[model samples]
Target: MNRKIVEAANIAINNLLPTKSRSLYDIAYNRFKKWCAEKNVQLYSENVFLSYFSENAKNYKSSI
Candidate 1:
C-alpha cells in the first residue's frame, strides 16, 4: 500500500505538471509525504485522506 501510494502520487503529480516544473510538484508532494509520515496514516486510504484534508486543506489552499 505504501509503495502503491507513492507510485500513484508520482503519476498523478507528473500528469498535472510539465516536466520542467516538476520541482514545484516535488516540493508540494514532499509536504504531503511528510504529513502522512507524521500522522502514521496510509497515504492512499480514503478515510485517512479525507480526515487529513479536512484538517489541513486550508494550509494547502493558503500556499497556492
Candidate 2:
C-alpha cells in the first residue's frame, strides 16, 4: 500500500508540471528525496517540509 502511494505520487509529480518547468521540478524533487533518505525521514508531514525549507532557505531567492 505504501509502495503504491509512493508510485502514484511520483507519477503525479512527473505529470502535473508544465513542460518547460518539469525538468526543474523533477531535479528539485529528486534532490529532496535524496535528502530525506540521507536523514532517514520516512514520513512526510508539514514539519518535514518546514525543516527542509528552513534549512535550505538561503539557497533560494525571492521572486519579488
Best by lDDT: 2
Predicted model with the maximum TM-score = 2
Number of clashing residue pairs in every model? 0, 0
Tell me the whole-model lDDT of each prediction, alpha carbons only: 0.80, 0.90
lDDT of 2 by residue, 1-64 (tens): 6999999999997788789997898899999999899989999999999999987888888889
Please give the range of 10 consecutive residues that has the lowest summed lDDT in model 1: 55-64
Q: Give the alpha carbon lDDT tens digit for every residue of 1-64 in model 1.
A: 6999999999896688788888987897797788888888665788877877787867566635
Candidate 2 is scored at a TM of 0.68
Question: What overall lDDT, based on C-alpha atoms, would model 1 receive against the true structure?
Answer: 0.80
Off by over 4 Å in 2: 1-15, 61-64
Clashing pairs in 1: none
Question: Against the hidden reference, what TM-scores do the models get?
Answer: 0.52, 0.68
